[model samples]
Target: MSTIDHPNTEATSAEARVTSDPVLVSDVVRSDRLLLADNTVKNHVIAATGVSLVPVPLLDLAAIMGIQVDLMHELCKLYDVPFKEKLVRSLLTSLAGAAGTVVAMATLTSLAKTVPMLGSVAGAAGLSATAAAVTYATGRVFIQHFEGGGSLSDFDPVQFKELFKAKIKEGAQVVKSFKPKSTTNTDQTAQTV
Candidate 1:
């Protein structure tokens, strides 16, 4: 039997070492984007009503999820992992539970809208808060998974459910901490006037 020449073990080991390291991206930028998306969803959830409200959170969530997927794609490229569009789409679709949460929020908001005063009093605040929490959880999940060298194939939503629930509580705190820009602007205007 003819023997084939093997490549240098040292070269293979060096390549493995280089590839194993985590890719460095700007966490600040990522966090800012995630926050912006969460705020946008919150705003939309607050402003929308009736049938219009049903889709707003879902749409915003989809947009934010898209951005997160793009961020993941960049990380995958840097980490020398495969990043296929199909895989990204599959991962996004697998987040149906989050979408279902948004839908539930929308349904509640719609029912609340049927009542005259309850729409503004209960639905807006409650649904918007839920929207913020859900958005935050989604962003956090993607960040944690991608940062931990997880790929689309490696993702398991069932395994992440507990972490996502914990993150929702943290997200509520973050949302509570956000001071609306309109309030800040009004304060500045009052000072100037």
Candidate 2:
């Protein structure tokens, strides 16, 4: 009879311990997914800010809606949620109430732009900042839902109403303090080319 040898039981034991704890494994996976999702969210928010800086009230709102819908769609894909355009639009409309404060601010600022000169400058700056903040808040709300294993089908905006408001506050602060990182690599590559 041939004897079978088991090598490195200690290493095997360590591996076994890691596999045995599903919470730890899931946490690591969630962390990685969160990092990727955050990058996706940030890119969408930047797009929203740029589009919202148009200084036209109704027109800016329409542009922001498209950007926000795309943001939610991308988030849904990341979280493996079914993306239904109708439902997304409906849900966004529901969130409009929750985001009323920022929306109202944007509207007023946009109206100011009609006067020209300083008004245009202030309106553009305010719109961009508020636009970024609102997008950030919306992304954070969806992220919290997805993180909790809730899909778009089960997401209740009412449940997250207060949270949405709080996130907006945090987002505004973040946007105000944020300094844009120069695309040095892309800049250098273009120069070389």
> What is the model-wide C-alpha lDDT for candidate 2?
0.83
**Per-residue alpha-carbon lDDT of model 2 for 1-193, expressed as tens digits?**
2223556666788899988956777788899889988998789878877875675666887788888899999999888999998998888878767778777887887777887789888887788888788888889999999999998889898898899889888888877667666677888999999
Give the winner by TM-score: 2
User: Against the hidden reference, what TM-scores do the models get?
Assistant: 0.48, 0.78
lDDT, candidate 2, at 101: 75
lDDT of 1 by residue, 19-122 (tens): 89756577765676556544544443233222134434345345544654555565555445688877776665566464566546645754564566656456
The list of candidate 1 runs beyond 4 A from truth reads 1-106, 180-193
Model 2 spans with C-alpha error above 4 angstroms: 1-25, 180-193
lDDT of 1 at 11: 79
Query: lDDT per model, in order?
Result: 0.59, 0.83
